[model samples]
Target: VLTTFDLDEYVHAALRAGASGFLLKDARPDELLAGIRAVAGGDAVIAPALTRRLLDEFARYGSAPTDDPRVDRLTEREREILVAIGRGWTNGEIAARLVLSESTVKTHVGRVLAKTGARDRVQAVIFAYDLGLARPSVR
Candidate 1:
Protein backbone atom coordinates (compact mmCIF):
# COMPACT_ATOMS: atom_id res chain seq x y z
CA VAL A 1 0.00 0.00 0.00
CA LEU A 2 3.02 2.29 0.33
CA THR A 3 4.63 4.08 -2.60
CA THR A 4 8.27 3.48 -3.46
CA PHE A 5 9.26 7.12 -2.99
CA ASP A 6 9.00 6.85 0.78
CA LEU A 7 9.97 3.20 1.01
CA ASP A 8 13.11 3.62 3.07
CA GLU A 9 11.58 6.05 5.53
CA TYR A 10 8.29 4.20 5.69
CA VAL A 11 9.81 0.77 6.06
CA HIS A 12 11.92 1.89 8.99
CA ALA A 13 9.03 3.78 10.54
CA ALA A 14 6.71 0.86 10.02
CA LEU A 15 9.14 -1.39 11.80
CA ARG A 16 9.40 1.07 14.66
CA ALA A 17 5.61 1.35 14.76
CA GLY A 18 5.26 -2.42 14.61
CA ALA A 19 3.80 -2.56 11.12
CA SER A 20 4.20 -6.01 9.57
CA GLY A 21 5.02 -5.67 5.86
CA PHE A 22 5.37 -3.41 2.81
CA LEU A 23 4.40 -3.27 -0.87
CA LEU A 24 5.00 -0.97 -3.79
CA LYS A 25 2.12 1.18 -5.05
CA ASP A 26 2.27 -0.47 -8.46
CA ALA A 27 1.81 -3.96 -7.08
CA ARG A 28 -0.64 -6.17 -8.91
CA PRO A 29 -3.78 -7.16 -7.09
CA ASP A 30 -2.66 -10.76 -6.80
CA GLU A 31 0.72 -9.68 -5.49
CA LEU A 32 -0.97 -7.43 -2.96
CA LEU A 33 -3.19 -10.29 -1.88
CA ALA A 34 -0.17 -12.53 -1.53
CA GLY A 35 1.66 -9.87 0.45
CA ILE A 36 -1.25 -9.49 2.84
CA ARG A 37 -1.48 -13.22 3.32
CA ALA A 38 2.25 -13.51 3.87
CA VAL A 39 2.21 -10.72 6.45
CA ALA A 40 -0.78 -12.23 8.17
CA GLY A 41 1.15 -15.46 8.37
CA GLY A 42 4.12 -13.68 10.04
CA ASP A 43 6.19 -13.33 6.89
CA ALA A 44 7.82 -10.27 5.37
CA VAL A 45 7.48 -9.56 1.67
CA ILE A 46 9.24 -7.11 -0.68
CA ALA A 47 8.59 -6.36 -4.31
CA PRO A 48 11.48 -7.36 -6.60
CA ALA A 49 11.92 -3.79 -7.83
CA LEU A 50 11.90 -2.46 -4.32
CA THR A 51 14.38 -5.10 -3.28
CA ARG A 52 16.68 -4.00 -6.06
CA ARG A 53 16.40 -0.40 -4.95
CA LEU A 54 17.25 -1.45 -1.40
CA LEU A 55 20.33 -3.25 -2.60
CA ASP A 56 21.39 -0.24 -4.61
CA GLU A 57 20.95 1.96 -1.60
CA PHE A 58 22.88 -0.43 0.59
CA ALA A 59 25.72 -0.48 -1.88
CA ARG A 60 25.68 3.28 -2.07
CA TYR A 61 25.98 3.46 1.70
CA GLY A 62 28.98 1.13 1.64
CA SER A 63 28.16 -0.39 5.02
CA ALA A 64 29.28 -3.85 4.11
CA PRO A 65 28.59 -6.82 6.39
CA THR A 66 32.19 -7.28 7.42
CA ASP A 67 32.43 -3.67 8.56
CA ASP A 68 29.38 -4.06 10.74
CA PRO A 69 29.83 -5.10 14.36
CA ARG A 70 26.51 -6.89 14.44
CA VAL A 71 27.36 -8.92 11.37
CA ASP A 72 30.68 -9.83 12.94
CA ARG A 73 28.90 -11.29 15.97
CA LEU A 74 27.07 -13.91 13.90
CA THR A 75 27.95 -17.57 14.29
CA GLU A 76 28.99 -19.69 11.32
CA ARG A 77 25.50 -21.16 11.12
CA GLU A 78 24.00 -17.70 11.07
CA ARG A 79 26.46 -16.74 8.35
CA GLU A 80 25.27 -19.75 6.36
CA ILE A 81 21.70 -18.60 6.77
CA LEU A 82 22.74 -15.12 5.64
CA VAL A 83 24.30 -16.53 2.49
CA ALA A 84 21.16 -18.51 1.80
CA ILE A 85 19.11 -15.38 2.29
CA GLY A 86 21.39 -13.59 -0.15
CA ARG A 87 20.69 -16.30 -2.69
CA GLY A 88 16.98 -15.53 -2.40
CA TRP A 89 16.23 -18.92 -0.87
CA THR A 90 12.94 -19.42 0.88
CA ASN A 91 12.85 -20.72 4.41
CA GLY A 92 11.62 -24.06 3.15
CA GLU A 93 14.45 -24.25 0.64
CA ILE A 94 17.06 -23.31 3.22
CA ALA A 95 15.56 -25.76 5.68
CA ALA A 96 15.51 -28.57 3.17
CA ARG A 97 19.07 -27.88 2.09
CA LEU A 98 20.33 -27.73 5.65
CA VAL A 99 18.28 -30.71 6.83
CA LEU A 100 16.48 -28.53 9.32
CA SER A 101 12.82 -27.90 10.11
CA GLU A 102 11.16 -24.77 8.73
CA SER A 103 10.76 -23.47 12.24
CA THR A 104 14.45 -24.01 12.88
CA VAL A 105 15.31 -22.14 9.72
CA LYS A 106 13.07 -19.32 10.81
CA THR A 107 14.88 -19.20 14.11
CA HIS A 108 18.21 -18.91 12.36
CA VAL A 109 16.80 -16.19 10.13
CA GLY A 110 15.59 -14.26 13.13
CA ARG A 111 18.97 -14.60 14.72
CA VAL A 112 20.60 -13.43 11.53
CA LEU A 113 18.32 -10.42 11.43
CA ALA A 114 19.16 -9.54 15.01
CA LYS A 115 22.86 -10.15 14.62
CA THR A 116 23.19 -8.31 11.34
CA GLY A 117 21.07 -5.38 12.54
CA ALA A 118 19.11 -5.69 9.32
CA ARG A 119 15.72 -4.10 8.98
CA ASP A 120 14.60 -7.22 7.08
CA ARG A 121 15.81 -10.15 5.08
CA VAL A 122 16.29 -8.00 1.99
CA GLN A 123 18.71 -5.78 3.82
CA ALA A 124 20.49 -8.79 5.30
CA VAL A 125 20.92 -10.22 1.82
CA ILE A 126 22.34 -6.90 0.60
CA PHE A 127 24.74 -6.82 3.51
CA ALA A 128 25.88 -10.36 2.81
CA TYR A 129 26.48 -9.67 -0.85
CA ASP A 130 28.17 -6.35 -0.25
CA LEU A 131 30.59 -7.90 2.22
CA GLY A 132 31.29 -10.92 0.01
CA LEU A 133 29.81 -13.10 2.71
CA ALA A 134 27.65 -14.66 0.05
CA ARG A 135 29.49 -16.21 -2.85
CA PRO A 136 28.30 -16.61 -6.43
CA SER A 137 28.15 -20.37 -5.93
CA VAL A 138 25.41 -19.90 -3.37
CA ARG A 139 23.48 -17.79 -5.81
Candidate 2:
Protein backbone atom coordinates (compact mmCIF):
# COMPACT_ATOMS: atom_id res chain seq x y z
CA VAL A 1 0.00 0.00 0.00
CA LEU A 2 1.41 3.33 -1.08
CA THR A 3 -0.55 6.48 -0.56
CA THR A 4 -0.40 10.11 0.54
CA PHE A 5 -3.03 9.52 3.20
CA ASP A 6 -1.45 8.89 6.58
CA LEU A 7 -4.67 8.70 8.51
CA ASP A 8 -4.57 6.01 11.21
CA GLU A 9 -7.74 4.34 9.97
CA TYR A 10 -6.26 3.70 6.55
CA VAL A 11 -3.15 2.26 8.11
CA HIS A 12 -5.22 0.01 10.34
CA ALA A 13 -7.49 -1.08 7.52
CA ALA A 14 -4.58 -1.83 5.20
CA LEU A 15 -2.87 -4.00 7.77
CA ARG A 16 -6.13 -5.66 8.76
CA ALA A 17 -6.79 -6.40 5.08
CA GLY A 18 -3.40 -8.23 5.03
CA ALA A 19 -1.26 -5.72 3.22
CA SER A 20 2.35 -6.81 3.63
CA GLY A 21 3.65 -3.25 3.66
CA PHE A 22 2.54 0.37 3.62
CA LEU A 23 4.75 3.16 2.43
CA LEU A 24 4.04 6.82 1.95
CA LYS A 25 4.19 8.26 -1.56
CA ASP A 26 6.97 10.60 -0.52
CA ALA A 27 9.19 7.77 0.72
CA ARG A 28 12.67 7.66 -0.79
CA PRO A 29 13.13 5.37 -3.75
CA ASP A 30 15.59 3.21 -1.83
CA GLU A 31 13.16 2.88 1.06
CA LEU A 32 10.41 1.86 -1.32
CA LEU A 33 12.62 -0.78 -2.86
CA ALA A 34 13.60 -2.03 0.56
CA GLY A 35 9.97 -2.24 1.60
CA ILE A 36 9.11 -4.21 -1.51
CA ARG A 37 11.94 -6.59 -0.87
CA ALA A 38 10.98 -6.96 2.75
CA VAL A 39 7.42 -7.76 1.84
CA ALA A 40 8.47 -10.17 -0.89
CA GLY A 41 10.60 -11.99 1.64
CA GLY A 42 7.52 -12.55 3.86
CA ASP A 43 8.06 -9.75 6.34
CA ALA A 44 5.67 -6.90 7.04
CA VAL A 45 6.49 -3.20 7.07
CA ILE A 46 4.82 0.07 7.85
CA ALA A 47 5.96 3.58 6.96
CA PRO A 48 8.43 4.59 9.67
CA ALA A 49 6.93 8.02 10.20
CA LEU A 50 3.47 6.57 10.65
CA THR A 51 4.27 4.15 13.45
CA ARG A 52 4.09 6.59 16.33
CA ARG A 53 1.26 8.52 14.79
CA LEU A 54 -0.77 5.33 14.46
CA LEU A 55 -0.15 4.45 18.08
CA ASP A 56 -1.14 7.90 19.26
CA GLU A 57 -4.32 7.89 17.23
CA PHE A 58 -5.33 4.50 18.60
CA ALA A 59 -4.64 5.62 22.14
CA ARG A 60 -6.78 8.69 21.65
CA TYR A 61 -9.76 7.53 19.64
CA GLY A 62 -9.95 3.91 18.51
CA SER A 63 -13.26 2.16 19.08
CA ALA A 64 -13.72 -1.37 20.31
CA PRO A 65 -14.51 -4.07 17.86
CA THR A 66 -17.33 -6.59 18.32
CA ASP A 67 -16.66 -9.25 20.93
CA ASP A 68 -14.05 -11.79 19.93
CA PRO A 69 -14.63 -15.30 21.29
CA ARG A 70 -11.04 -16.23 20.65
CA VAL A 71 -9.81 -13.68 23.17
CA ASP A 72 -10.84 -16.01 25.93
CA ARG A 73 -8.01 -18.33 24.93
CA LEU A 74 -5.18 -15.95 25.77
CA THR A 75 -3.15 -16.50 28.88
CA GLU A 76 -2.20 -13.51 31.01
CA ARG A 77 1.30 -13.53 29.52
CA GLU A 78 -0.07 -13.61 26.04
CA ARG A 79 -2.32 -10.67 26.84
CA GLU A 80 0.71 -8.69 27.98
CA ILE A 81 2.50 -9.62 24.78
CA LEU A 82 -0.40 -8.23 22.75
CA VAL A 83 -0.26 -4.93 24.60
CA ALA A 84 3.50 -4.71 24.08
CA ILE A 85 3.02 -5.40 20.41
CA GLY A 86 0.34 -2.69 20.20
CA ARG A 87 2.82 -0.23 21.73
CA GLY A 88 5.16 -1.13 18.85
CA TRP A 89 7.60 -2.99 21.04
CA THR A 90 10.01 -5.26 19.30
CA ASN A 91 10.40 -8.90 20.40
CA GLY A 92 13.60 -8.08 22.21
CA GLU A 93 11.91 -5.22 24.04
CA ILE A 94 9.03 -7.46 25.03
CA ALA A 95 11.43 -10.11 26.30
CA ALA A 96 13.39 -7.63 28.37
CA ARG A 97 10.37 -5.91 29.84
CA LEU A 98 8.60 -9.13 30.63
CA VAL A 99 11.77 -10.79 31.98
CA LEU A 100 11.33 -13.73 29.69
CA SER A 101 13.75 -15.29 27.24
CA GLU A 102 13.43 -14.10 23.65
CA SER A 103 12.22 -17.54 22.61
CA THR A 104 9.58 -17.48 25.32
CA VAL A 105 8.39 -14.07 24.19
CA LYS A 106 8.19 -15.38 20.66
CA THR A 107 6.03 -18.27 21.75
CA HIS A 108 3.73 -15.99 23.69
CA VAL A 109 3.46 -13.68 20.71
CA GLY A 110 2.53 -16.59 18.49
CA ARG A 111 -0.19 -17.59 20.91
CA VAL A 112 -1.56 -14.07 21.07
CA LEU A 113 -1.83 -13.88 17.30
CA ALA A 114 -3.41 -17.31 17.06
CA LYS A 115 -5.94 -16.56 19.75
CA THR A 116 -6.83 -13.17 18.37
CA GLY A 117 -7.04 -14.31 14.73
CA ALA A 118 -4.52 -11.69 13.70
CA ARG A 119 -2.55 -12.55 10.60
CA ASP A 120 0.59 -10.76 11.70
CA ARG A 121 2.13 -8.46 14.26
CA VAL A 122 0.65 -5.39 12.61
CA GLN A 123 -2.81 -6.92 12.78
CA ALA A 124 -2.24 -7.83 16.39
CA VAL A 125 -1.40 -4.19 17.08
CA ILE A 126 -4.73 -3.16 15.66
CA PHE A 127 -6.46 -5.86 17.70
CA ALA A 128 -4.96 -4.60 20.91
CA TYR A 129 -5.96 -1.06 20.13
CA ASP A 130 -9.50 -2.02 19.21
CA LEU A 131 -9.88 -3.97 22.44
CA GLY A 132 -8.67 -0.96 24.42
CA LEU A 133 -5.87 -3.12 25.78
CA ALA A 134 -3.19 -0.61 24.90
CA ARG A 135 -2.76 3.11 25.53
CA PRO A 136 -0.02 5.69 25.62
CA SER A 137 1.16 6.93 28.96
CA VAL A 138 1.64 10.59 29.84
CA ARG A 139 5.26 11.50 30.13
Candidate 3:
Protein backbone atom coordinates (compact mmCIF):
# COMPACT_ATOMS: atom_id res chain seq x y z
CA VAL A 1 0.00 0.00 0.00
CA LEU A 2 3.05 2.19 0.30
CA THR A 3 3.88 2.01 -3.37
CA THR A 4 4.06 5.03 -5.69
CA PHE A 5 0.33 5.08 -6.53
CA ASP A 6 0.27 8.57 -5.00
CA LEU A 7 -2.39 9.37 -7.63
CA ASP A 8 -3.82 6.30 -9.28
CA GLU A 9 -7.23 4.75 -9.79
CA TYR A 10 -6.26 2.02 -7.36
CA VAL A 11 -6.60 4.47 -4.51
CA HIS A 12 -10.19 5.15 -5.53
CA ALA A 13 -10.91 1.45 -5.84
CA ALA A 14 -9.47 0.90 -2.39
CA LEU A 15 -11.89 3.45 -1.00
CA ARG A 16 -14.82 1.83 -2.77
CA ALA A 17 -13.75 -1.54 -1.45
CA GLY A 18 -14.38 -0.50 2.13
CA ALA A 19 -10.83 -1.04 3.13
CA SER A 20 -9.90 -0.10 6.68
CA GLY A 21 -8.22 2.76 4.85
CA PHE A 22 -5.59 3.50 2.29
CA LEU A 23 -3.06 6.26 2.38
CA LEU A 24 -1.58 8.08 -0.63
CA LYS A 25 1.56 6.04 -0.13
CA ASP A 26 3.37 9.29 0.67
CA ALA A 27 1.06 10.29 3.47
CA ARG A 28 2.78 11.49 6.60
CA PRO A 29 2.18 9.41 9.71
CA ASP A 30 -0.24 11.98 11.10
CA GLU A 31 -2.20 12.02 7.87
CA LEU A 32 -2.39 8.23 7.88
CA LEU A 33 -4.21 8.43 11.19
CA ALA A 34 -6.93 10.56 9.67
CA GLY A 35 -7.42 8.04 6.86
CA ILE A 36 -7.72 5.19 9.32
CA ARG A 37 -10.25 7.06 11.38
CA ALA A 38 -12.30 7.96 8.33
CA VAL A 39 -12.60 4.39 7.12
CA ALA A 40 -13.01 3.12 10.66
CA GLY A 41 -16.04 5.35 10.90
CA GLY A 42 -17.39 3.85 7.66
CA ASP A 43 -16.69 6.90 5.56
CA ALA A 44 -15.20 6.92 2.09
CA VAL A 45 -12.34 9.23 1.34
CA ILE A 46 -10.70 10.07 -1.97
CA ALA A 47 -7.89 12.37 -2.93
CA PRO A 48 -8.87 15.74 -4.32
CA ALA A 49 -7.50 14.94 -7.75
CA LEU A 50 -9.64 11.85 -7.99
CA THR A 51 -12.63 13.70 -6.64
CA ARG A 52 -12.28 16.30 -9.32
CA ARG A 53 -12.03 13.71 -12.05
CA LEU A 54 -15.01 11.83 -10.76
CA LEU A 55 -17.03 15.01 -10.78
CA ASP A 56 -15.91 15.76 -14.30
CA GLU A 57 -16.71 12.27 -15.40
CA PHE A 58 -20.14 12.54 -13.93
CA ALA A 59 -20.66 15.80 -15.72
CA ARG A 60 -19.50 14.23 -18.96
CA TYR A 61 -21.98 11.40 -18.50
CA GLY A 62 -24.82 13.88 -18.00
CA SER A 63 -25.19 13.25 -14.32
CA ALA A 64 -25.10 15.90 -11.65
CA PRO A 65 -21.57 16.52 -10.58
CA THR A 66 -20.59 15.90 -7.03
CA ASP A 67 -20.04 18.87 -4.81
CA ASP A 68 -16.51 19.03 -3.48
CA PRO A 69 -15.60 21.39 -0.72
CA ARG A 70 -11.96 21.27 -1.75
CA VAL A 71 -12.76 23.15 -4.97
CA ASP A 72 -14.12 25.93 -2.81
CA ARG A 73 -10.99 25.83 -0.70
CA LEU A 74 -8.86 26.81 -3.67
CA THR A 75 -8.20 30.51 -3.78
CA GLU A 76 -7.86 32.59 -6.94
CA ARG A 77 -4.13 32.71 -6.31
CA GLU A 78 -4.01 28.95 -6.02
CA ARG A 79 -5.83 28.56 -9.32
CA GLU A 80 -3.17 30.71 -10.95
CA ILE A 81 -0.52 28.58 -9.30
CA LEU A 82 -2.12 25.43 -10.73
CA VAL A 83 -2.18 26.88 -14.22
CA ALA A 84 1.51 27.67 -13.92
CA ILE A 85 2.32 24.22 -12.68
CA GLY A 86 0.24 22.73 -15.48
CA ARG A 87 2.38 24.58 -17.95
CA GLY A 88 5.33 22.58 -16.66
CA TRP A 89 6.94 25.70 -15.32
CA THR A 90 9.47 25.35 -12.57
CA ASN A 91 8.82 27.09 -9.31
CA GLY A 92 11.38 29.71 -10.21
CA GLU A 93 9.72 30.21 -13.56
CA ILE A 94 6.33 30.48 -11.93
CA ALA A 95 7.61 33.05 -9.49
CA ALA A 96 9.02 35.14 -12.28
CA ARG A 97 5.84 34.91 -14.31
CA LEU A 98 3.59 35.77 -11.38
CA VAL A 99 5.92 38.45 -10.03
CA LEU A 100 6.11 36.65 -6.72
CA SER A 101 9.16 35.61 -4.77
CA GLU A 102 10.48 32.09 -5.32
CA SER A 103 9.89 31.26 -1.70
CA THR A 104 6.33 32.47 -1.94
CA VAL A 105 5.78 30.35 -5.01
CA LYS A 106 7.20 27.36 -3.19
CA THR A 107 4.82 27.96 -0.32
CA HIS A 108 1.94 28.21 -2.73
CA VAL A 109 2.95 24.96 -4.42
CA GLY A 110 3.07 23.22 -1.08
CA ARG A 111 -0.36 24.54 -0.19
CA VAL A 112 -1.74 23.43 -3.55
CA LEU A 113 -0.35 19.95 -3.08
CA ALA A 114 -1.84 19.70 0.41
CA LYS A 115 -5.18 21.11 -0.63
CA THR A 116 -5.45 19.10 -3.83
CA GLY A 117 -4.21 15.91 -2.18
CA ALA A 118 -1.51 15.81 -4.82
CA ARG A 119 1.52 13.79 -3.81
CA ASP A 120 3.94 15.98 -5.73
CA ARG A 121 4.22 18.54 -8.45
CA VAL A 122 4.25 15.83 -11.09
CA GLN A 123 0.90 14.53 -10.00
CA ALA A 124 -0.41 18.04 -9.67
CA VAL A 125 0.66 18.64 -13.25
CA ILE A 126 -1.16 15.55 -14.40
CA PHE A 127 -4.23 16.56 -12.43
CA ALA A 128 -4.22 19.94 -14.05
CA TYR A 129 -4.05 18.40 -17.50
CA ASP A 130 -6.87 16.03 -16.74
CA LEU A 131 -9.06 18.82 -15.45
CA GLY A 132 -8.26 21.06 -18.41
CA LEU A 133 -6.90 23.67 -16.06
CA ALA A 134 -4.07 24.18 -18.51
CA ARG A 135 -3.53 23.17 -22.08
CA PRO A 136 -0.39 21.41 -23.14
CA SER A 137 1.93 23.78 -24.86
CA VAL A 138 2.81 23.21 -28.52
CA ARG A 139 5.59 20.72 -28.83
Candidate 4:
Protein backbone atom coordinates (compact mmCIF):
# COMPACT_ATOMS: atom_id res chain seq x y z
CA VAL A 1 0.00 0.00 0.00
CA LEU A 2 1.31 3.41 -1.02
CA THR A 3 -0.44 6.46 0.24
CA THR A 4 0.21 10.05 1.21
CA PHE A 5 -1.77 9.79 4.39
CA ASP A 6 0.36 9.32 7.48
CA LEU A 7 -2.51 8.84 9.90
CA ASP A 8 -2.33 5.97 12.31
CA GLU A 9 -5.99 5.08 11.95
CA TYR A 10 -5.64 4.53 8.23
CA VAL A 11 -2.61 2.37 8.76
CA HIS A 12 -4.49 0.29 11.27
CA ALA A 13 -7.42 -0.09 8.93
CA ALA A 14 -5.22 -1.16 6.07
CA LEU A 15 -3.44 -3.68 8.19
CA ARG A 16 -6.73 -5.02 9.43
CA ALA A 17 -7.78 -5.39 5.84
CA GLY A 18 -4.80 -7.67 5.19
CA ALA A 19 -2.44 -5.31 3.47
CA SER A 20 0.84 -7.19 3.22
CA GLY A 21 3.00 -4.07 3.09
CA PHE A 22 2.73 -0.37 3.54
CA LEU A 23 4.85 2.43 2.05
CA LEU A 24 4.53 6.13 2.03
CA LYS A 25 4.05 7.88 -1.27
CA ASP A 26 7.35 9.60 -0.68
CA ALA A 27 9.30 6.34 -0.43
CA ARG A 28 12.14 5.83 -2.85
CA PRO A 29 11.56 3.81 -5.99
CA ASP A 30 13.84 1.06 -4.78
CA GLU A 31 12.05 0.85 -1.46
CA LEU A 32 8.65 0.63 -3.14
CA LEU A 33 9.81 -2.10 -5.45
CA ALA A 34 11.33 -4.02 -2.58
CA GLY A 35 8.19 -3.68 -0.51
CA ILE A 36 6.13 -4.97 -3.40
CA ARG A 37 8.47 -7.89 -3.85
CA ALA A 38 8.44 -8.71 -0.18
CA VAL A 39 4.66 -8.60 -0.04
CA ALA A 40 4.48 -10.72 -3.14
CA GLY A 41 6.75 -13.22 -1.45
CA GLY A 42 4.19 -13.64 1.35
CA ASP A 43 5.87 -11.38 3.88
CA ALA A 44 4.48 -8.34 5.60
CA VAL A 45 6.19 -4.96 5.80
CA ILE A 46 5.55 -1.60 7.38
CA ALA A 47 7.15 1.67 6.56
CA PRO A 48 10.13 2.30 8.81
CA ALA A 49 8.97 5.71 9.92
CA LEU A 50 5.60 4.35 11.03
CA THR A 51 6.88 1.33 12.87
CA ARG A 52 7.51 3.03 16.19
CA ARG A 53 4.13 4.65 16.22
CA LEU A 54 2.46 1.38 15.33
CA LEU A 55 4.15 -0.32 18.24
CA ASP A 56 3.29 2.59 20.50
CA GLU A 57 -0.35 2.28 19.57
CA PHE A 58 -0.32 -1.31 20.68
CA ALA A 59 1.45 -0.46 23.93
CA ARG A 60 -0.60 2.58 24.76
CA TYR A 61 -4.08 1.29 24.02
CA GLY A 62 -4.03 -2.43 24.75
CA SER A 63 -6.34 -3.61 27.48
CA ALA A 64 -8.46 -6.57 28.67
CA PRO A 65 -6.19 -9.54 28.13
CA THR A 66 -7.82 -11.14 31.13
CA ASP A 67 -11.36 -10.09 30.31
CA ASP A 68 -11.47 -10.97 26.63
CA PRO A 69 -13.43 -14.09 25.77
CA ARG A 70 -11.55 -14.55 22.51
CA VAL A 71 -8.88 -16.29 24.52
CA ASP A 72 -11.28 -18.21 26.72
CA ARG A 73 -10.78 -21.40 24.75
CA LEU A 74 -7.03 -21.45 25.15
CA THR A 75 -5.42 -23.61 27.79
CA GLU A 76 -3.05 -21.90 30.19
CA ARG A 77 0.00 -23.29 28.38
CA GLU A 78 -1.41 -22.32 25.03
CA ARG A 79 -1.98 -18.81 26.33
CA GLU A 80 1.64 -18.61 27.34
CA ILE A 81 2.64 -19.73 23.89
CA LEU A 82 0.38 -17.11 22.36
CA VAL A 83 1.99 -14.37 24.38
CA ALA A 84 5.40 -15.56 23.31
CA ILE A 85 4.28 -15.58 19.69
CA GLY A 86 2.90 -12.07 20.13
CA ARG A 87 6.30 -11.01 21.37
CA GLY A 88 7.58 -12.14 17.98
CA TRP A 89 9.47 -15.10 19.37
CA THR A 90 10.50 -17.88 17.05
CA ASN A 91 9.52 -21.45 17.80
CA GLY A 92 13.08 -22.13 18.86
CA GLU A 93 13.06 -19.11 21.13
CA ILE A 94 9.74 -20.11 22.62
CA ALA A 95 11.00 -23.63 23.12
CA ALA A 96 14.12 -22.39 24.94
CA ARG A 97 12.16 -19.94 27.05
CA LEU A 98 9.51 -22.45 27.98
CA VAL A 99 11.95 -25.35 28.40
CA LEU A 100 10.04 -27.34 25.80
CA SER A 101 11.07 -29.04 22.61
CA GLU A 102 10.71 -27.22 19.30
CA SER A 103 8.11 -29.72 18.14
CA THR A 104 6.08 -29.11 21.27
CA VAL A 105 6.24 -25.39 20.68
CA LYS A 106 5.16 -25.84 17.11
CA THR A 107 2.26 -28.00 18.20
CA HIS A 108 1.21 -25.46 20.79
CA VAL A 109 1.38 -22.72 18.19
CA GLY A 110 -0.84 -24.70 15.85
CA ARG A 111 -3.35 -25.26 18.61
CA VAL A 112 -3.28 -21.61 19.52
CA LEU A 113 -3.92 -20.59 15.95
CA ALA A 114 -6.75 -23.06 15.57
CA LYS A 115 -8.40 -22.22 18.85
CA THR A 116 -8.15 -18.52 18.26
CA GLY A 117 -9.30 -18.76 14.62
CA ALA A 118 -6.10 -17.15 13.38
CA ARG A 119 -5.17 -18.24 9.89
CA ASP A 120 -1.40 -17.89 10.29
CA ARG A 121 1.35 -16.77 12.62
CA VAL A 122 0.89 -13.19 11.56
CA GLN A 123 -2.82 -13.35 12.26
CA ALA A 124 -2.07 -14.96 15.59
CA VAL A 125 0.27 -12.12 16.42
CA ILE A 126 -2.41 -9.61 15.54
CA PHE A 127 -4.90 -11.52 17.66
CA ALA A 128 -2.49 -11.44 20.58
CA TYR A 129 -2.03 -7.73 20.17
CA ASP A 130 -5.75 -7.11 19.86
CA LEU A 131 -6.40 -9.10 23.01
CA GLY A 132 -3.63 -7.28 24.88
CA LEU A 133 -1.83 -10.51 25.61
CA ALA A 134 1.48 -9.07 24.40
CA ARG A 135 3.09 -5.66 24.45
CA PRO A 136 6.02 -3.86 22.98
CA SER A 137 8.87 -3.41 25.41
CA VAL A 138 9.51 0.16 26.35
CA ARG A 139 13.06 1.39 26.14
Residues 3-122 of candidate 4 have per-residue lDDT tens digits of 999989988888877676778999999999998887777556789999889888878885566566658889999999999988989889999999999999989988998898775666
| lDDT by residue for model 3 (1-139), tens | 3345765467545433433344466677776677667655644345444555544442344223345565467898998998798676888899998999999998898888789877666456545665667655543
lDDT (tens digit, per residue) of candidate 1 on 34-95: 98897777567777666655555555664444576776699988888998998779999999
Order the candidates by lDDT, highest first — what do you get?
A: 4, 2, 1, 3
Candidate 4: residue 120 lDDT (0-100): 61
Candidate 4 has its poorest 10 consecutive residues by lDDT at 61-70
Which model scores highest in lDDT? Answer: 4
Q: State the number of backbone clashes in model 1.
A: 0
Better of 2 and 4 by TM-score: 2
Per-candidate count of clashing residue pairs (backbone under 3 Å)? 0, 0, 0, 0
Q: What lDDT does candidate 3 reach at residue 51? A: 50
The local lDDT score (0 to 100) that residue 115 gets in candidate 4 is 92
Query: Which portions of model 4 show Cα errors greater than 4 Å?
Result: 2-4, 24-43
Q: Where does candidate 2 have its weakest 10-residue lDDT segment?
A: 64-73
* Candidate models: Cα lDDT each: 0.73, 0.83, 0.64, 0.83
Which residue runs does candidate 2 get wrong by more than 4 Å?
4-9, 64-67
| lDDT of candidate 4 at residue 79, scale 0 to 100 | 94
Q: Which stretches of candidate 3 lie over 4 Å from their true place?
A: 1-69
